[model samples]
Target: MTAVAAGTALLLTGCGLGGAPATAPVDTGGKVEGTITFQTMQLSPTFDDYLNATIDAFEAKYPGTTVKWTDIPSNAAARKVSADAIAGTLPDVMDLDTGTLAPLGRKGLTVDMATAAGDVKDSYVATAWQSFAFGGTGAAALPWYLNTPVLISNKAVLGKAGLGSSPDPTGYDELLTRSAQIAKATGVAGFQPTETGFANSLLTVGVPLVDETATKAVVNTPEAVAFVTKLAELYRSGGIPKDSVSAKERSEIETFSEGKTAYLESGGSRLKIIKENSPAVFGSVAVGKPLGDAAKRTWVVAHGLAVPTKSGNLPTAVAFAKFLTSAENQLALAKVSSVFPSTTASLNDPFFAVGDGDLTAAARRIAATGLRDGRTTVKPPAADAEYGATLWSAVQPAILGDVAPAQALGDAEAKLTKILQERQK
Candidate 1:
């Protein structure tokens, strides 16, 4: 799994959908003063100081407002939120992502941030803000932190393949060609796709997953079929590892760190993990722009602050949500982590522009450039997991050369179209 997939998995596991319709939005007319519960996903011991300090500052700003902070393990957060929603005891303010916020927004459990706080809309990147908007629910949360994938390569592996230590591929085709040569020469896999699956892979190559109305799947086109065929050929030729066809993100990292793979596409935040787990491999890694349309259509993952519609103190909750995502607070967090701030002004900080000629710094600089065009690429109105599962199940056979590429994609399109139709009803 790449860092992006690992982070996404953490968020997705915590997003549980409920069947009940929620209460209407709270009136936003009162003073921003009250005791409000705040919940966070998996930011505990390591960030205890920063979070407490921020909470203290918020309380100071709004005298009389007492903020109660609770941090939950990422795997347990979704269930806690769902249980609270059922009991009508949801936190006034919660940290959430697009996946966790979607079903709640659909059921009217969250405040319409875009409507209640429309004046602050321009404070965030347009795509980041839009990510929280679901069908007819308006924007459900305030955009917070974000990350985009960057290309990381092993110079030693590339050199062994006779490509220069710093060879750069202009696009995916060239990258694949180089990967094949590296595998043949060095007896190592050249690349490994994240276990999160290939939906993003198709999207990165210009394959439209849905039609204009989002009412049909249109990925059974010639371009998609050709891509799948190429992937199968690559798999058969040993350019991609056999176990990687079903391995998790951790496996992908291990493979790369062990020098079994030459390239990896992951969030820059992962550089620290590599440095800690495999110092030798980390020393040889180089950061560069993502290949192909990925450079132009970078996949972004964003987390946000949400206020439940049932909060006892809606005004205070919303106020804190805005304060937490403000340019100043966001930059403070970004300065200490690999995440980029959603606020436009935060990106202008010199820290993002400066590189110290090291792997981590280079990755941060490259990722910030990609963030200007970054967006959440595969957002279906409903049944997002089902959509990915359908694609993976249908495409896996073709990738293993057990089914024809065209037939596999045709089946996937048919199944995805049915899913879209069912969602419409």
Candidate 2:
């Protein structure tokens, strides 16, 4: 069966092999007073004061309700959440991204926020709200904060390469050419895509990682192959870092901070770190739109709140999730961080709509503009992550000259097909 079909069957039979209760419809109305544990990904300690204050406000708004919030480190979050889900101890409300929600959604572990969200649906950005709808399922999460990609440049290095003040790349080809020029002229890598995971790179350029329905691989298309080839060429030409094949987004940020790269692909939120770690580079920093082909569209990374279907306090949990994602609360979080709020009402606040004379404000405005226009990349089923990891691992050999791009993609496709077959069983 297709993954979606399998998921449907699984849900119909009760969400688990042990006969856990079937998924429940969201309950948005009625009295809501109970303790709900909220699991977040790395929002603690640093944002503790802000979060605590918000929780306090929530408690004050809904008397007799207690919110116990905990944050799991991002690196180990997936495994931790898996363990929790298996133990039937998932938090009542969860802060989740698209990738993490895929398996949960498939298992029918989350509430259908579309029904639960009520009038609040119109409060959130359309794209953000739409992102959490998995496999044609109704939205299972309430959109919260967003991070959108932008092309950040070191003006000094660009000037040294003879690229004009704005050095905005028109497309991937232009990006590669400019990167080669910058490397040759200034001895600095020309560019780095914000998310260095190869699959993510393809997604940024509007290449779908798998066929629609998530049943098979589609990465061997002419456009995708050309993208992979250009990336391999860039790596070979010294325009991309040697270690970048396995690099994460933070690595690119570090390279840019250290002044080792001319163009750093990252979100506007990085401006704070750049200003703190490399004040001089920060002075030379210029933000531009993300580069892509005609299919070029900006990417928005969003984190939202979800309630597990098995939660005993379904009404309370759904209520708390909505409370946390409400426009007032969302804007409160946005005021204290570089991340943009997901709600249209929050985005319309003077805080996001107007830019001050400062660089941070300008950066925020640029990111906000991008978020308003960008599309959120759809993550496939849980198995798609495995497929992506395999693809990333397999492509490095091709990029490093160990194999041809076509051969590498073909092998990856075959492995993905095998995975799909196994899922059918």
Best by TM-score: 1
Model number with the top lDDT: 1
The weakest ten consecutive residues by lDDT in model 2 span 1-10
lDDT by residue (1-425, candidate 1, tens digit) is 10111223223224433334545656776798989999888877767887899999999999999999998877666566666776788899988766656667766779998788889999888767876876556688998888677788888888888886545775567777878888889888888865253666676677767775555898898878988888788888889887777444346677888888898887887788878879999888888887643436556667889888878998999999999999999989888777888887887778788877877878887777666545335333332455776787788888889999999999999988876654444
Q: Tell me the whole-model lDDT of each prediction, alpha carbons only.
A: 0.74, 0.70
**In candidate 2, what are the lDDT values of residues 297-372, reduced to their tens digit?**
5556567788887787877888888888888988888888878888877777777666566766766776666555
Cα misplacement distance, residue 84 of candidate 2 (Å): 2.8
Candidate 2, lDDT over the whole model: 0.70
Name the Cα RMSD for model 1: 3.8
lDDT of 1 at 368: 73
What does candidate 1 score on TM? 0.88
